[model samples]
Target: MRYEVWAPSASQVTLHADGRAYPMRREDGGWWRRAAPGTDGTRYGFALDDGPALPDPRARRLPDGPDGLAAVLDPTLSVWRHDWPGRPLPGAVLYELHVGTFTRTGTFEAAAEHLPHLAQLGVTHIELMPVCPFPGTHGWGYDGVAPWAVHEPYGGPGGLVRFVDAAHALGLGVVLDVVHNHLGPSGNHLPAFGPYFTDRHHTPWGAAVNLGEPEVRAYFTNSALAWLRDYRLDGLRLDAIHALTPRAPFLPELSSAVDELSQSLSRPLFLIAESDLNDPLTTTPRSSGGHGLHAQWNDDFHHALHTALTGESQGYYADFAADPAQALAKILRGGFFHDGTYSSFRNRPHGHPLNPSTTPPYRLLAYTQTHDQIGNRAQGDRLSAHLSPGLLACAAALTLCSPFTPMLFMGEEWGARTPWQYFTDHPDPALAEAVRTGRRREFAAHGWPSDAIPDPQSPETRLRSCLDWDEPKREPHARLLAWYRRLIALRRATPALTDPDWSYTALSTDDRTVHFRRGPVHLAVNLSPQPAALALGGTAAIVAAWSPVAPPDGAGVLHLPPETAAVLLAT
Candidate 1:
């Protein structure tokens, strides 16, 4: 087999395999190559001249974590079962999950056991958090070091293949979350090999990746393509594109490459980005002078819904709390609440206006709660812990009834009480200590007592975060699950609910009550502490209602209980 390593920073490179070193020929662009007698499962590392041996930059399998040698993996080894046609954006409902804590076993195969449950829950796609091998046994998967290696703790490469195959057999598409902004602090060896990162640009995590570099761009683009082609993944959820610097050609190039691959595969492959920039150009087509990404996480919609329900005004929630009704209205109608408006949290004018006619509503992924929203909190408490049952149902009604695509965090359907805290298992003592200290300090700034912050290095923290699994069958939990099922079923059956025509959508609010109209369907949510009533424009039938104190009267007047939400069909 011909082995190659990209070490533009080194003048001499060698391939070390099976206790033998072979001097490699340096080609243009600082790539070194050599032929070796190695098949699948061969352990190897690259040595720079007389320097210490380092794993491949694109190691596909790191059986012993990121600090060990790379294992050669053959992509054609796994057998695929189903011919998945892939789900489209308009009707897709995504369920985001972390494999490590998704089930009691925390392995890909163990997580696959629940695929039938998700399929039964009306989920069209299963979005797994980053599975790339990092320094730890378990984590949130954002701080991945080996971008190409399947996480060893989560059943490794073969396990992921099996999980994907199982999901396809159950008629569910898979989407992977990928981190390309920055590598983790531990087990990072890219700097020793090449200029994979740059000190010229700084991100919240650390030095931003050297995305403008041709070789570096190719590395990430290829990784994105491999997931879609090799793993048979239907889509990729790019983590935090707003963090990348010199983002012009890098974002567009990545999008163009993936689009090309999707066409070539004759399948519906998608590229979704998580961004805080609130810029419409992130999802705009490349032909129209935009990046051409298919979709983006609409945090504005999440914040608006969250603030309206929980009355949370801390941090970025302050922006949405200023006028939550208006914010929700803007997001539902135009896809952004702070479009070119002054943001007190950002301390500047944030976001660009999106033309409702040109931008599709499905390009925005709306959610009431996600890993970051729940896990980043001091206690990692879900909205169910704070809001009343009625309010929680209200939040769900707004999220599912909106024109944008809807996503639910794992265990969110039944309002799982487990705290999805940030936990890691870095073997290095110093790195682990740093993580523990940093988490405490970060939350302290948000007014949380240092002692109240959970230690991210604690194994108990991870253990406590596992889903109860029994919660879904209990009262209130079971009811919430049924509500979610009904919402999803209604969305599938009603053409108006699934329609992406934002122009046909309208929003109206009065005090604590907000009314949204999408085609023939109308959603009314009361955020007030007391009961409220709104006059229906015309005769309507109640499609769904939670904790409804009073139904529509003979005069076509709808009465809602405190923190209640109702879905009505225009008659």
Candidate 2:
């Protein structure tokens, strides 16, 4: 219940609480400590020396929005009647969603209306994209300035609390995506206080957050802990950890801090890092001389799968277009394409050697399509707009049945036609224009035409990104929805499809179909125009297939309909 304010620039600091101000003693390294209203849930802010009162960088609970007073919330407060033993993280199916577009009202309470639907979809965990306060109402949330405060439009802190509490009550774990690499451009006023960033360590966005600086580390780490400590969040989906450069002792410091914080938390606090560097040390245990992060986003698996399905070999996808079965084999068993293989895109060998015995297969989170894959496009179009239904189903089946954990974008389940584009509502006119201009140029480097790019500043872009709530009830949308439900149900029910062994899984592809086998699961996908005969795995049991052909094949010889997927089992 105590409050700590890091304001090195200010000479004197006072606790603005209970409609009265009390002086706080300056503690270690410019931090002001006070024992004011530790028992009472009073709202407080740090009044600088003759300057305006500033919100605490490590504010536990915000009651009056980001610009308003901060509150000291006790965890024991407000009855938490729900009690159930915890479940392991390996078997979870995560559904990633943006709070702004998940509902019409877009508040946490509003999002609660869809709980039954999530439960029915077999979504074990719901990963909310960054809810931290940004410049305006809508965004992809990577540009978050006030990392401690929830976005006001999404009903602020109380709404987020309600959402998490509700999710737990429904037996759904909530993982909050947090941005620790850099703050947003417009409303980011952190540097006004002290050296929160350093020029020596620069990210793609301005100077990186000075994690090595005494107070800066406290600010960032404390902000991350707030969600788990106050919001009762189950895990932290760390964003762009490759950019989180700790100047001194980078690996152990950041990883140990996260590991320690997870241990200190009330419930199991899992940390999933979004890292591009395919280093095995990321998920390795601390005792084994590695960072103790629980898991990391598997972009290699995505790139491999994406290139194989679409055959659009450009940018990073250049390394993965040789064979469809390569992706099918790597993602199904080992988890990544760059498993010490020579990466032509990087012009050198990338990724360290992974220990099959030491490294757990579940340390990677895989997906065929996601918000980044959809939104990063010039037109903000989903894969459904580009690929055939059969190819799309092939990609979906691989993601769901793969050994590594699977995560779905908001509308990905039902094949929602509406796009999850990269949209931002930056109130500043100059900042908005800069963003639009920057985005266009960024895409141009990757061979995208300038004229084809959508302006990020335009209202049309944001409107286009909104989930068409009615897409679920329509023709192709309804069909895709049923397909996803059946696939997910099979994934949950079938033990063969859930096997996690990168080395053991095998794939064989010809002009006819792609054969994938992981343990007892055998998925034969017919990609040709004609009715391609599927050669099932020798040891696999017949569980299910997409019924690839029109009429069912008798004699226990499955007839795969054209462009359909057959999920089978080895008995």
Candidate 3:
């Protein structure tokens, strides 16, 4: 077998495999290679300039975690039981889940047992949070050091293979979230191997990954393809593309490569970027000189809707809180609220306007809450913790009934009571203390008492984030779940709800209510504390509603209870 590594800075390279060491010869493009008698399950690592051996930068399986030696395993060797066609993004209802806390056992095998529940929930795709190897057994999976390998604690590569196969059998597509901007602080050995990162640009984590180099770009691109091709994943959700300050046009290049692979496989493979730039170019076609990603997370819509429902005016929520209804109305008509507008949070003009005629609304993924929105909070409390069942149903109605592609965070369908807190497991005591201190200090600066903030390093914090399966079987929770089921069913059944056209969409708002129309379907949400009598443009029949909605009056006005939403079909 041939062993290879990229260590341009090293004068000497050695391949340590299967308890034997062999000198490697320098190859072109800053790579070192050597042939050895080894097969699958062979332990391997690379030593640079007589230094300690490090795991392969692109190791497919890290059997002993990121700090341990990598195992040589053929990914194609895994057997797939089901044949999956593919699921596209146009009309998909995405459900994002974290593998560790998704089930009681926190393993891929255990998570697979709940696939039937998601299929029944009417979500077309399950977006799994990063499963790459991190420091410990539990985490949000964002600070993963190995961008290519699966976390062994979550069943490694084979476990993910089995999980995807099971999901395919249930007619569900799986999308994995990937982090390429920066790796975790501890156990990251990429810099030692080569100039994978550069000090030319820095992100929140530190030096950015060097994407200008041809070989470095290939490293990340190949890792993404391996996940989709080898694991049979439908797509990938890129975490924070805005943080990446690549001197080269990496997004466009990545998209082109992915498109070529999608053609070869004859499947609908795609990429979704988590960007706050509010740039339509992120989703525009490559031929039009755009990045050509299939879709992006619409944080503008989330902020507007969140502030409206919760009356929050802190930090980024300040701008949206001024006039909640108007904010929601603007996002409904166009795709973004910031569209070349001044942002009070940033104190600058942010985002470019998107043409409704040129850009389809479905290119934006809208959600009520996300991992960052929930987990990063002081207490990691979900909206369900404070909002009533009626209000939660209202949020469901607006998102599902909107023109954009809707996504649900795990346990949102049933309003899972457990909090999805920020938790980490770093074996290093000093690193753990630093994380604990930083988390508390950040929240404390924002007026939250330090004691009120959960310790990210505490084991109890991770346990508190697990979803309670029994919650869905109880009152209010069961009712909310039923509401989500009906809303999703209606979206699938009603052509107007899933319509991608933005020109056909219209919105109107009063002091306490926001109304929008998608073709013949009109949705009105009452945001006030008192009952609202919203004027429908024409005579309509109540199709779906969060609470008991009174019939339209003689003048075509519907009386909706406070904190309620109704979807009406024009007669």
Best by lDDT: 3
Task: Mark the regions of model 3 whose C-alpha exceeds 4 Å error after superposition.
Answer: none
lDDT, candidate 3, equals 0.90
Model 2 C-alpha lDDT versus the unseen true structure: 0.74
**Going through the candidates in order, what is the number of backbone clashes in each?**
0, 17, 0
Error of 3 at 175 (Å): 0.7
Off by over 4 Å in 2: 1-3, 14-23, 35-44, 47-49, 61-81, 247-267, 444-451, 503-506, 537-542, 548-559
Please write out the lDDT profile of model 3 over residues 479-511, one tens digit for every residue. 889889888998998998878778554578876
TM-score against truth, every candidate: 0.98, 0.90, 0.98
Model 2 deviation from native, Cα RMSD in Å: 3.0
Residue lDDT tens for model 1, 264-377: 988898889999998888988998988999899999999988888877898899998877888888788889988999999989999998866657899999999999998989
Better of 2 and 3 by TM-score: 3
Q: Each candidate's lDDT (Cα)?
A: 0.88, 0.74, 0.90
Q: Which ranges in model 1 have alpha carbons more than 4 Å from their true place?
A: 548-551
Candidate with maximal TM-score: 3
